[model samples]
Target chain A: MSSWEPDSDFVFHMPTKVLYGPGSHREIRAEMADLACDRAVIVTDRGLRENTDLPARIQKALGATCVGVFDDVEPDSRFEIVDAGAAFAAKLGADCLVSVGGGSSMDTTKAISIVMTNGGSIREHLAVHALTGPQTPHIAVPTTAGTGSEVTNVALIKDEAARTKFFVLDNQIFPRTAILDPTLTTGLPAGLTASTAMDAMTHAIEAITSICRNSMSESFAVQAIGMINGAIRRAVEAPEDILARGTLLSAATMAGAAFCNAMVGVVHAVAHALGGVCSVPHGIANSIMLPHAIHFNAVTDAEAYAPVVATLGIKASSPLAAAQMAAARLTELAASCGLQTKLSQVGVNRRQFQEIADKAMADGAVLNNCRPVAGPEEIVALLDAAF
Target chain B: MAVVFPTAEWVAEFKKQIDEKPDYKEGGKGWREGVIVLIINAKPQVGIDADFNIYLDLHEGQCREARVCSDEEVGDHPFVIRGEYDRWKLVVLDQLEPVKAMMQGKLKLTGDLPTIVRNIDGAKTLVKCATYVETVFIDE
Candidate 1:
């Protein structure tokens, strides 16, 4: 026998190191040393840095090698933030970038990392796998458990020109190390807690039911679904339950990883539209549209949703039942958390529904949904039903 | 005697409809299991105190086993629901009960989410099927 490896039919490629647990939120100097990151800059939003000494703490942990901080990242961040971040990093001669805070900050870091290496505007680097250039070491530290920003290879960058959100899907965006620390999320607002948790739940379910989902992705999605279902309620009701918060953080990161390898569906696309159009908060927008989107998708893609429903411990008979159960459960969870389910309730009108639908169709994420949803007619119908 | 064709009788008839309906049969092909439903008139707004447990299992697109049980003898199956009969009737009859209400536990839900989602259309089919054979005050 030659003791050689045989040709395989399947392979899973995941390179990020996930360090989780209580207070694993320290500076990544030790990890940076491993990744050969000597000059590092922490990318964060002003809100996170507001009257907080956390950045100093990171500097202390990282020692004298820590570069200057780029604190201009904003929620629903524009691509200019990416440019500014890269320019700042270049000025400081930073070799590594660490993101702290939620989706906005992490997305900024991913965007900056790409442009800094590729030498162009974010628009030029929009296509999937477009960045053939080498990427600098980027570590994502997600403060919230929602966007799953740390592990996803996709970065949602607001295209201010097109007036719609566009995502950059490239392997370069996936963080080298994702540090899941529940402590970092302790400062999150109650509303954000519910919204982000729901967003995480959406990611897991959408991934589980996505058209491109394979068995491995499904397994990860199921675990994430169960965890989010159990954890979101607790985190919403009682914000201090570190264990539950940690579980949600873990679920979000895992979902990001799972969906990064796979892809998300229409709910994300619709939510992104809300962001680009109305500026509804990302997580809240996703939470509002989730069940309706699930029900809509269920009519065409119920079989794909079975495992997700099963993971949530729903009792059902067929694929349609599984999808219904998931949708129904999401509604229940939403009500309990005081989250609104209707688009009308959220100040969106019928006209905007069609407008959002049009925008959603143009969204790149919607192209990856389990089934092809054509335009605003059905989406308008679904939105009306949700209302 | 065909079970007297009351609500219970309609339950059987409902099962028969699901078996006969081509769309339902096709949609429910992968569904082969039992569900126990707990119908409760918690608020009694309808002035009719109806509380009963319906044990049901669908075997190959047909509702094979069904029995209305006492509250004390709640059987083990994947589905259990507790809510006002008015809500259930509204859900079954009008088929237009607010979806958010049904999902948010305002109507009361407890069971396996996967099984429920997989059988949602089938569940709707079951409700419609039962209504077709019953003389209940259900209108289109």
Candidate 2:
């Protein structure tokens, strides 16, 4: 494990089979059939359920295969809700899960699957490798271009009582198949589209700079970054532009795959903490924190960010300068989509800074940060700068 | 006149330093848990056993108690962060980042990872407080 060598003794997990295209959503029934699953339970949010005819369309596609629709999933997946969803699935005799929405729906289905198979509360499976048992197979149909929960072996579940967010990390949790249909994301609002695409970009940038990055992860991350940089503007300007949506969808999945192996850095760390403490949305937090975390890492590991800068179309004489340019470009792109660039603008108070910094330090993302964090002062400084 | 490592005076000095740092007090304000730093391979220069533990009663931005825990008391803490003598020395000497060292498996952690993570800022502050202690290593 030399300093320069990309290869290391790493175990790469690629279990999700991706079905990508303009109309891949229709492949849901066939994928379920291939998995020997007939009774499919659709887990989604109330917003998606009312706004789109997607549920009806999916039910019609599944015909007799569709057994139930648990549309009670909240914005951030919660334990009680997921537990109820598992009960609904069990009552409906669902053989498999069809998650239809953004990260919330996908993560809800993952947690429900764990409960369905393992027969325990979401709390038992919060730590890494906590799920030694198998899970009910899940097919994720993402309706948004962010989260990348379909391919990643991680699930973010919040405890409503504690008002704190926790995660389930396991190799067995990746969806058996991911249906990446661009049509599902065409109806998303411009603000959401921008934030979501920025989320994918953050995933790529962080993965490339993660300490555990390998060649395979780097390849996926670089390609995802390029796709996102080239197409996000078009996707935001013209929501129905199929090509841009398709590219963004592909990029999100690619970033998901990349980060699953390479892990993510401080951007995700601070973002997760913000999401927990301030009630800031995940993509918005990622969007606001991306540039700050990038600049922070670039100061120490400039060479690691060279490919990231290249993907962002920034070329400079020095790696640090190039990285700075890449961060600036992201800020510009985020503003173009109507996303805010500061913490105070998003309702995070000055008093909460210390708590946010504390939570950020606790996040697993801090461990994978490309550069060593000096301590809480450095983290507070980063938060203050972002603020 | 440096305080020797693994001494009550050193622990007392470390506690004083922690109380003096505004950042630690602010960053660890939400934390209400006890942590034990267990060290193994006590150097021959220190007339201690092969293993000893430092108990830190950290709660709500204050170090309420700091003392050496007997072997029977090590498991009583809500959080226990363990490592060898060399790794502990490097961390206290500012030669290693405590969080990174734990993530890299240079230090071992037990008892509730998520809780420990939620207090990560405090943990780092604790380590920072350790480095601020002017101590003479037993090996040195």
Candidate 3:
């Protein structure tokens, strides 16, 4: 019964079969056998290779078909890598595209799943891109809670030509089910914890302010905001706090689900561009840029910001104070997590920003931002403000 | 304005306070090293010199070496929280608050992300087992 209509034409969809809570991967593997999957392509990263035993666990648990490993992934996954993974899936005759990491693996799997069924280079299907044809079943096993790729049809692939991040979003790519397991994230480092937590926060706030905002999205975003506001610091400070980690996992999953349906805006649009151009890490880029983006958008919805401030639990003597408080709090949270809240600190400069901005304006994400980005100029201005 | 605590005696006082807290000891059970906090004036909003760092170390269960940041001694902070001295102290002394400052940008931190979380978990407390002149944020 998960159905919602947008305007007069589009309808929103969420994954029907969801496996949530700790150690849910086992249950997900059980479903693979039920689906009669013989072999599956495991799309993952080099980091996961060392940190977890996902591939082996899958092989042991499901007794299903196992495609050869495709671990040629970077933190900011590239288009070429996804293209290679797709070919690998085809070579293995893999029926299902199984992802075993965060956005990097899940997004890569989505792109590859489409390319496996469609006969063309990824470049062919660029904007408003649809599979336009039948595709193999895709299953998402999210190791982290951010980017809600498991629940949405959005697949972000890095475009080398435009040097931008593009979402090949369509209903066909949504995974049949998503595995939300908190144990999967216990080993996450503090930097990743803080960075990804902020990434989820960005997703929630951006969705809350999106042009397409609605009741369902607001409900999810509000819950996400509260969970993060209460538990993120504890998760960042204590890796072993399963309760805190679980809360963050839920928060991230909720944020991901919210944005996947509602879409994201400038912060993500700009973050995606930075990832493609400079190869900056997605979570860190979001952590550093979210404040500036939020500040920039604040002027667009001053009254709306009041609810956000209340959600953040801020009380100021004045509006100016409130604004300044929001900015400072962003910096402090990032700093406490061993992150700096500035693009300047992360090696992004004015010259590079101009190029990134041009690409970001064209990115699909900006359309969802509360204040529409008019052109590269406004993008650069935001970058300047962040710096 | 000098550090709100001023007396420099507060440095030793923090060492004493840190040693006295069983929760701090339990929270930091696995944390074996120390960290230095760099409090730059940023702007001489309150008074005092423009820059200085506080060198605080957590060794096993004891708090050691609370000193002023000497000239030519920049920071190699394992974990760092940066801001105006007043705001920094407000957090350190458990006065400023957590969600309040994070939302306001009064407190900032940097260093290894993994270790940061580990330290907090080991310490089992927030504001990362102090290492500040005063306790900041309520105990979580």
Candidate 4:
């Protein structure tokens, strides 16, 4: 039986145009033109600027229209970096943005676009539905298979002073186009591939079990889960396999589309808190917490998770058993991928559990958890168990 | 006779229903937040010639007050939800979910989103209260 009732009402919307192929990144000019944007700025990081030729290739593809490159984005994109990037883009007379890296870079571009058009500090527009209409045109070329920031309407910006991250969600911030070029992700290291694929997997699972999930989001989540399950191992072990890489990239976008509408659950809430409190990498935190979160919500969401079990290729006696097995299988899969399976392995301490729990309680994602958490103590217990 | 929506009587009745519901009292226990002002945009075609502001003084699972307020009286409330008259009608009629409507840009919400999101059950209870009111559509 489906989680949604026959008479349940839902609203589904996906506005961004996605171009997926081996070398779709080269279509930057056409994508920009589709939005009637002329001057484009490439928003990325210094690592991609120094190590890879992807930025240059996109610049060349955009030719005269590509005004400049802003590579000031950090690993966890900060508010200051977005402000600086926005100023740089505005100075260059850039009318559009082409983000050319992972989640941080793409999210930076989204924030920069908001600041450029709205003409204020990124902090001013922190509320949901903050923007009245669209912001600057943005084309996201994701070099990592995680985050799926290209399709999501949210940008996670860290506040250095507060030592926590905050979400800026608005439909207008969704990238105008997502260029999923698998070749851009083929050179990722084994650990990154594993961690990022796990991130996508977590997104699919959480979307499936989120209280707000509808048929359309569930369909995408299921498809993404199946694809990631089939391709993640090959994509990680044989990093150069284009087919596996492409599958993971496509699945990540599908997962993004799913969770963007349905929203995620406690896994993301805890992961965001971990990223904020401990400086643990987002994907790594999600990879470590995915199975544990599943276990926590499984009792209440067994029916919703049963499909995830099948998608993960697990066989079980019943829905509840299937949910439990699904959690166990995720642990095994994370271990096989060489991902850190516990918070302790990632340098998180018992003392920090309280702070992490406090932050997680305040997270927007927690609202949609299949199981309602009474207080921070429950999260502390979950963290203790994961530890 | 059905109380005409946007009138002072409708707001009083809505508050009465909210106070009577045990679900609202229980579900809203966590909601110690400040007032929520609903701005119903004018639809002149439907005879609502000017914007209507309904101020809800809600705290700790109780409706302290529900009354009509002027623009100046809205005054620094923690949450403000603005939408077309028709959209608000759909929400009051339980045909549309408020959170989903906000997510879809059909309604504009200005507040700490996480707080509102966390108290979604409370919000739903408030909406249920609206449905209990015997309302007559102004357009009809």
Candidate with best TM-score: 4
- DockQ of each two-chain model: 0.01, 0.12, 0.01, 0.52
Better of 2 and 3 by DockQ: 2
Query: Which model, 1 or 2, shows the larger TM-score?
Result: 2
Better of 1 and 2 by lDDT: 2
By DockQ, the best candidate is 4
TM-score of chain A of each: 0.92, 0.97, 0.91, 0.98
Global local distance difference test of model 3: 0.68
lDDT by residue for model 2 (A285-314), tens: 999998998789889988888888766667
lDDT of each: 0.71, 0.82, 0.68, 0.87
In model 3, where do residues sit more than 4 Å from their true spots? A1-11, A34-36, A317-324, B1-140
Q: For every candidate, give the share of true A-B contacts it also has.
A: 0.00, 0.16, 0.00, 0.58
TM-score of each: 0.69, 0.77, 0.68, 0.93
TM-score of B-chain for each predicted structure, in order: 0.70, 0.87, 0.65, 0.96
Candidate 3 residue B136 Cα shift, in angstroms, is 70
Candidate 4 residue-wise lDDT, A161-263, digit = tens? 8877877788889998999999989889888998998999989888888888888988998999889888989998888899999999999999999899888
Tens-place lDDT digits, model 3, residues A1-387: 111234422124565377777777777556777667767778788778876776556555555466567887766566788778878888888888778888878888878888888857665554232244546777787777667778877677766675656566566677877777788788888888888888898888777776656558767887898898788889878888888988988888888778766667788888888887877788888877787776787676544445456677889885545655776787788788788677878887778988788667656567667776667889888888877
CAPRI quality level assigned to candidate 2 from its DockQ score = incorrect
Candidate 2 Cα misplacement greater than 4 A, ranges: A1-4, B1-112, B116-140
